[model samples]
Target: MPLGSVRYERVIAASADDVWALIGRPERLHDWFPGITACSVEGNRREITLQSGLSLPEEITVLDDRLRRFQYRIDSPFFPYHRGTIDVIALSDTSCAVMYATDCDPRTMALVIGAAAAAGLDRLTEIFPTPIFPTPE
Candidate 1:
């Protein structure tokens, strides 16, 4: 089946290293990702609890500190095929860009996840509030 993908990016006034420090930890999803009430990881598997009290199981497929990126796959009935990645790209010494991308089956699934992803990006700004001037590319 052809996969559907969605991506969202945000520029934060912080170094890439700082951004990575916060997001690199798989267990910290609750801190920046909206609606995630809790996150726990065991080996490569993770469980995330939503505000609605729904728990979702996910597998940590990739954790690349060198590239400041990590990818995970959701194992849930709602999305039969789901894989998501978070990447932090350095834009400047004092700023960086965060990218969240997801691929799933039934193309329309991307839209459902994209809304939460957008809110997650918004939550990131709350953590790093110094918004730099030059727009992100």
Candidate 2:
């Protein structure tokens, strides 16, 4: 089956620079991403411990501070083809938007990942509240 993709976005009250500083760091993923109880990174490899105590391995494929974006791939036999990317776009000096995207084989995987992404964004809003007005076009 062809790969399926999902994208989720949330507006944050914090500045893009602030959000980037935190989210851009792969080691700090557990802070915002839901269900990630712990995270450890060595070089480009990362291991995340979920709430269920299951450890999932992932590889950091891209970390672009210039663009405030990062991409990672899950390493698991269960899902041979999986890739996730996160981008923080600056809507203003004190406001920004985060876009989380995932691509994986089997459409069902996209639904699961999309839920996780939505949950993560919901958690992030606690730190960065939703914008009152739409971000500038």
Candidate 3:
């Protein structure tokens, strides 16, 4: 099966720690992520409810606190072949970037996943405050 990956980059006006704080907080996922109605984490597992009333359970596969990166795999009926990681990098004191990437099976599902990625990124940008980076040189 062909692996489909969509990447998005956004410069936020927050420090890497700040962004990570928000992203790492399971309860705050729906605040910036669209379609997610709620999130809960137990042990190394996490569950999320979608706006469509669907729910997904995922296991935390990788969590690198030093690098501020999180990776997980979906194991639920709500999504087919849904697995991804979110990476955050600090650009400066008041600037940072986030990237989300996913790989799934059933090549035909690429379109749907791609659309979801776009919408999710759009929602993230909308919910996040404006960037506070200094004027570029």
**Predictions: Cα RMSD each:** 2.0, 2.6, 3.7
- Candidate that scores best on lDDT: 1
> What are the Cα lDDT values of the candidates?
0.88, 0.87, 0.71
Two-way lDDT contest, 1 vs 2, winner: 1
Model 2 TM-score (2 dp) = 0.91
Alpha-carbon shift of residue 10 in model 3 (angstroms): 1.3
Per-model TM-score on C-alpha atoms: 0.91, 0.91, 0.80
Q: Which residue pairs in model 2 clash with each other?
A: none
RMSD of 1: 2.0
Once superposed on the true structure, which residue ranges of model 1 sit more than 4 Å away at CA? 134-137
Q: What C-alpha lDDT, on a 0 to 100 scale, does residue 80 get in candidate 2?
A: 78
The worst-scoring run of ten residues by lDDT in candidate 3 lies at: 128-137
**lDDT by residue for model 1 (72-136), tens:** 99988878899999999999888899999999976787877776987887788878866776445
* Candidate ordering by TM-score (highest first): 2, 1, 3
Deviation (Å) of 37 in candidate 1: 0.7
